[model samples]
Target: MKLRALLLGILLTSPVATYGAGGNSVVTVNPPIPAPDWTLPAIQNAKGNLSMSDFRGKITYVDFWASWCGPCRLSLPALNALNSQFADDPVQFLAISIDVVEEDAWDFLKRYSVDYPVVIDTEGDIARTFAVDGMPSGYLLDGQGRVREIHIGFKRGDELKLAESIKRLLSDLVTSEVDET
Candidate 1:
């Protein structure tokens, strides 16, 4: 279809940075690429600005959400629970909102209180950088700052799968650290 062609054109034309042993060259992006760096203000904390690099040594679950996305209503609270579960572990959860009207997001937060840290991204630059094409997209980053998984949408049973992925990544981190030592 025309829509498919348009998307294909965009993908084929997209600029992808490539690294070489001797120098550098531009190449098409492959999967599991390094996530783009971004810094945003804390939406509900006194922590000031939070940069992606700050989570270098931790497993980061970056959830991109919006007030209008119904799945986010469920996803955020669930993420809070996951955050608590991983409280003692080296894991971090960042709920970044793309709500154009930040007041709306604030109101939603008022109704649904969460314990996890939140970042207000009204400009959506971070979401664009992540190429988030759906509501409630989640990016799982390993300790070394590589994108391990890109999850889209949310449903009733996705929680366990996410938790499993987190556990696997945590184990992988431990193994890698031991090997390095």
Candidate 2:
């Protein structure tokens, strides 16, 4: 974990505000690419492992966060509420903590409880695969696991914007299903 944390610090040297949406910026991937497959252990090992493929055929919102990241403190709770609003929908939300130390993540979660699945990327493999460049980054993936939108940083009202995007995607899914039938 220590080594992974060191490497991440070196790799994530870019300015946070340059790309993506939220309070900072949100960039739509020009040509959506398939999200890589990954299986990560649940935070504190309290639950079974989770994989990217598990949410297949659903609108997956994967959030990369850490207890130490300031923006993440805000993003998690907001996302939790958004997840509840779409509780009956085909949307699935997953939060992955990139904290080097496992305890830090637990401490943060104690105060800001979330309902969605939470996992810990102890080896940092998941974050590297997603090319996470900033703290509290989010990837909105389509049913087929394509990365449709990227969100970086979090600010007040950002959750509203995210909710709108999710609704648009859900509508798209409904349209496609109707066409198929």
Candidate 3:
């Protein structure tokens, strides 16, 4: 399609690099980029909408995925575990699904268990805003909402890096709080 071709052209021209074993993510944005702020409605018209500013004091992980994306299948489960691991910490995990069909997303959720918040971006605005180059792209933001790392794809052991990033952010927050006190 024309859109896919355009996206490919953009990726080819950008600083994007692909490196992953076993055909796993293949895309990585080095030197982590700063994430843009945005708000989106909940997946099912559920309670409160998701706003980037709401999690300013917490380590935030934002995942951009689609229901039909193969990598998302693997990414979701790993993300679920990471979300659970930080349940009591000052960490927030959010998923932005680019699925055109709401039902498809709902169906996929039934197959996978996710404990964090999920928002549906039918127009793909959030993904475009983040310049997602792959299906399972993720942005790890520090407490101040600056992107600390950009993960372009998913693979086993990926959660370790994410966990470590969260730990670092939490540690930094504690240090700052103590200094203030």
Candidate 4:
């Protein structure tokens, strides 16, 4: 209960910029501070290579998952949907597998056909760097490579909320750019 209250307080009190007509406001919650630079192994896609630095100047969704986890499997479709929804945008959806071996993760990807980049963290180093304690943990990073939101566990409608959050962040970035110009 105490942790929940603290989280809620942070969400409510964080700095936000309001936009849109009729005074409709969108809250822009800040991401948590990241640890010092650390390298983690990534499998890249079947045909291409991807690195964490490649997503610079774009909002990135880093999801840590495993093949055998039920919630992880459940979140796959939603993650796929999110990838499709933001297909034309600068936002990226990166699903990193924490499975013990690359074979299992590759097999699962082959069966699912997720359109986004799926990286294999065969040694679980990436998961440890992200402090992931659950199978379906997620971290949202802004264009500047700062962690925006960290989510754990799976719940219904989480994908929708995540998509909305991305949209809000994108909009905020655009608005900030306009103000600067």
Candidate 5:
């Protein structure tokens, strides 16, 4: 009876052996991708309806902002700089406005003279999807569309760090592809 009880206790407490830790263990999170098959209404500059799926092959930065937000205004130059820096690359910088009206957003964009693609989220649908709780939130998506980084507030040196991270991810992707081939 003692032996049986001891064996039962061990069986109950022991960790089960797992293949790669579990059947559904995450090896890695690629980067933020657009939500799966997410088709949004046509944004201002898009030729057709836009979805996160459209940018599947490139690294993407999605900025959730409102024109009235001071921090959002301040971050424009940095975002523009990033856009300029990666002008020739496959990375895309998208600014999504959470403004209630298109004119308010367009006015701000014109005032800023921002050069990157701007997507209007008039209904705040996209912002809600990303669980955005603050203005001027930035999300960096890897080339594979996984969320690689998320920033809620602006900081002085964030742009530089963001650029470096994207470059590093791009390099890693290239290196890995070469290795795989």
Candidate 6:
């Protein structure tokens, strides 16, 4: 209860910019912060384990979701579409399921198809590490692995705004690489 209240207050007070007229606001972190590195057992689209560092030097979008989350129903499919859109680009999408019961997550995934890698955080360790304040929380990390944007809730058409942000970040990354060259 206290955590929920604190999260609500933070969301309300955070400096979030609304994208488009959909009222979908993304919390852009000024001076992007380093994302906490993690390694988890991959459940879909791969074998063994995956680590955040393995995708370094690419735009990584870390999304925290669960089967019980209502917003995830919309977010999972939408995020999958976004993943496809950037398939040819230097971007990686990771979905972390915070379901205590592993079978629950599997059942949900059976219904909604997610093409990208999905990992299960059955013990909630990863969620606690990421400080997930809300369901379907998305962290957009730049190529350097710094979290550039944070989306707490999933609303209709939120993916469009997220796409725009990704494009802007990718552009910046490309320009920086060119400058270095």
Best by the lDDT measure: 6
What are the models' TM-scores? Answer: 0.81, 0.86, 0.82, 0.77, 0.76, 0.89
Q: Over the stretch 1-181, how does candidate 2's per-residue lDDT look in tens digits?
A: 4433433443355233243344466666545677888888887324888888999999999999988888887899999999999999999999999888889888999988898889999788878777787888899999999877778788978889889889989999999999999
Residues 1-181, model 4: lDDT tens digits: 3334443554456566343342222334454454223344455553455677878788888888888977776688888999889988889888888888788887777766577778777777667666665667777888877777766666557787789889988997798789989
Cα RMSD for candidates in order:
9.5, 5.4, 4.7, 7.6, 12.9, 3.7
lDDT of 2: 0.81
Give the per-residue lDDT of model 6 (tens digit) for 1-181: 4433443444567666554443335777776677777788988887889888988899999999999999899999999999999999999999999999888999999999799999888998767766687788888999888878778788888888889999999899889989999
Best by TM-score: 6
Candidate 1: residue 152 lDDT (0-100): 66
- Give the Å error, residue 93, model 1: 0.5
- Clash counts per candidate, in order, are 0, 5, 0, 2, 6, 0
Residue-by-residue lDDT tens digits, candidate 5, 7-32 = 23432343441112112111112323
**Model 3: worst 10 consecutive residues (lDDT sum):** 24-33
| Evaluation by TM-score, superior candidate among 1 and 5 | 1
lDDT tens readout by residue for model 3, 1-181: 3333444454566465445675544333343444667788887424568788877888898898888988788889999998888889989999889998888999998887588888989998778767677778887888888766667777888788778868988998899999999
C-alpha lDDT of all candidate models, in order: 0.75, 0.81, 0.77, 0.70, 0.67, 0.83
Judge candidate 4 at residue 48 and give its lDDT. Answer: 56
The candidates, ranked best first by TM-score, are 6, 2, 3, 1, 4, 5
Q: Candidate 5 — which pairs collide?
A: 31-146, 31-147, 32-145, 32-146, 32-147, 33-145
Candidate with better lDDT, 3 vs 6:
6
lDDT of 5: 0.67
For candidate 3, the per-residue lDDT at 30 reads: 40
Any runs in candidate 3 off by more than 4 Å, and if so which?
A: 1-18, 23-34, 44-46
